[model samples]
Target: MSGTIAFGLFAVVFVTSALSGVFGMAGGLILLWFLLLALPATTAIVVHGVIQLCANGSRAWFSRHYIDWRIVAFIASGGALAALGLALIDYTPNTAVVSLLIGLMPVLVWIPKAWFRFDASRPHHALSCGVVAGGLTIAAGVSGPTIDLFFIRTQMDRRQVVATKAAVQVISHSIKIVFYLHAALVLSKGQWGMVLLAIPFAILGTRSGNAILRRLTDANFRYWTRWIVTAIGVFYFLQGLWMVT
Candidate 1:
């Protein structure tokens, strides 16, 4: 990447990291879109995995007091199995398909809550979501909306929701990085350095976002988060259609 592009990406990371810090999801999807403009799909996925691993890790840590360890454990167990299964596969999905699925993810919230009544408090439900979310994150490069869906029916407050989701993403993204590395997706020294540089910005963004998050009422937060994610999902759907066409 050129110096100009690298600097631009740094700015993007800072801004998006803050967004994710507040919303718990949208930033990664937005970042992946920008990355696809500059890197091959496989390379973008690997780099995204690394960047998000750090971003979500920091978010989880910052909100560690609110994290639900039981949820994380259940999800991690299923995610580990999913990652191993994906690693054994010789084939990956085409980018268009993954993009389409991502596009449709946010809209899932519009479905009637009664239609999908998995109690997130149950370990089985969390494990099932983890398995599906793990596979989707590997294939699509972002699956935040899907993960968010699992928590919708839970009794968690906003802080707990964000913290727990961040923890689950940490596990998912870590598995993604390992699977890509196993698949021989090597980054250039410059790319690796860029990823490292992005981490601090991501951390800063998360901190700023958390500060902002503290001010929002739960109702307003949910309202804004849904719309923002929905808008991004539409963009992803259109982008996927354009790619396939």
Candidate 2:
């Protein structure tokens, strides 16, 4: 690869990982975009999942004390089912379809809360939520908001909320990586360099984001996450359109 491409990938790793920690969702859509520019779409998905599993897994582990085990178990179960289904399917939708769906999610999640003043709190059904999160995650790589919306309205405290989300994501992402490997989506030894090169930047970004979050009030974090999600959704939407054209 050219020097420019390598540098660009490194930059993306740093910025997206940092953003992920502060925002509660890891940067799958963004990461996928960068990887697509460098590799085939299928290979890009594999690389993205593998890198994210390593990077975000560390972040979640560092915050393991904050994790909710029950949530993790439920989400993992569902995500595994989704992964299996996706693996079995012969034909899947194109990137544009996935991107557009991802773009719509932020608005779908926020409009009810912001305009209707709706509190979507209902009883937690782990199996049901897990299935949805897993299926969408496999299809679009942007299920964080779905999972977030479910938990945020549950009257959970800030730390527990973040922790639970992290835990669920860890399990979900881990399953994705495993399934991808089994499906032959992951790269072999030749591609390991790029993946390894991304690690330091991701680590640095995670630390920086965590430091910033420490000072923010709960209300501030909420407002920040909502706006960021909206911006990210628009990003995916526009990128999807560009990809198709």
Candidate 3:
């Protein structure tokens, strides 16, 4: 990448990581879109996985006290199993199809709550959500919206939601990296350096977002998160449509 493109990647990682640290979602999807603009689809997916691993890992660590370990354990277990299965199959979807699914994901929130009455507090529900989200993550490069469904009915507060979800994503992203190891191997030294360069910015962004997250009321946080995610969804939807056309 040129200096200009590298700088742009760093800026997007910083801003989106901060957004994720505050909202518990949306940032990864936006980051993926920016990365796809700069890299091949497979390379973008692998790079996005690493950047998010750092971003969410930092967020989970910083908010360690609030993380729901039980939920994380259940989700991680299911996600890991699902991911392992996916890796064995070694299936890769068409980039346009993946983009379209990701574009449509956020709109799932609009579905009536009554249609899916399962409580996220149940261990089985968490595991099931993990399986589905994990599979989708491998295929689509971002499954934050699917994961959000598992938590929507839970009694967690804003901080708990962010912390727990970040922890769960840590597992998902790690699995993605494993599945994408071939792509990682093909990266040039400078590209590897670029990955390293993005980590600190991700950490900084997470910390900054966490600081802001502390000041928001739960209602306001949810309100803002919904709109931001919806806006991102629309952007991805258009991009995907244009690509297919």
Candidate 4:
């Protein structure tokens, strides 16, 4: 990769990591959007999984005390089931499909809490979230908005929500990496180097976003998260439409 391209990738990682650190999902959505512009569908999703694995792992570690292990275990099992099903079917989303799926993700966040009572704390609900969100993550390259629907309305405060979701995403991203490993191997050494170099920036960006996260109230966090994701979804949906045309 040229120095300019390398720098651009690093910058996107940092910025998106930071965004995730705060809202816990938008950054990955944005990062995947940027990646899809430069790489093949599966390749971009794998690269995105690698970067997000770092970001979510560090974010989970930073807030380890807040993680709910029971929820994690339940959701992971569901995610695994979804992965197995997808792998067996040998599914691979095209760029336009991925973009359209991602673009539609924001709508999950907009659903009124009264419309669908999804509590991530419950075993069945969490498991369902795992299957649905996990499948979406693999297909679309990001599932934050979908995952958020389960946690945001629960009694858990913002800290617990972020930490637990980060932990969930860490596992989810790992599954994505494995699912798309073959596609990722097609990358050249130089491209892989760019991805490796971008890791530190991802971690750093998470740290920076965490710092800002402390200041936001629960209400503000939810408010901004909804609008920001909705705006991004609109743009992505349009892009997907254009691609299809």
Best-fitting candidate, measured by TM-score? Answer: 4
Clashes of 1: 0
Tens-digit lDDT string for candidate 3 (1-245): 78998899899999999999899989899899888877778778899999999999999999999998988888888788788788788787666877888888888666577888554568999888788888888888888888887776678899998999999899899988888778887789998898899899999999999999999999898788777887888888888898899
Highest-lDDT candidate: 4
What is candidate 2's lDDT per residue for 79-194, written digit by digit as tens? Answer: 78777777888435457777887887787557565553322233246666777787776666558777776776666665666667766776776665565554343456646676
Which digits, one per residue and each the tens of the lDDT, describe model 1 over residues 7-84?
988998989999999989999999988887877676788888888888899999999999999999998888887777
TM-score of model 1 relative to the true fold? 0.95
For candidate 3, the 10 contiguous residues with the lowest summed lDDT are: 111-120
Ranking by TM-score: 4, 3, 1, 2
Two-way TM-score contest, 1 vs 2, winner = 1
Off by over 4 Å in 4: none
What TM-score would each prediction reach against the true structure? 0.95, 0.86, 0.96, 0.98
Which residue pairs collide in model 3, if any? none
lDDT of 3: 0.86
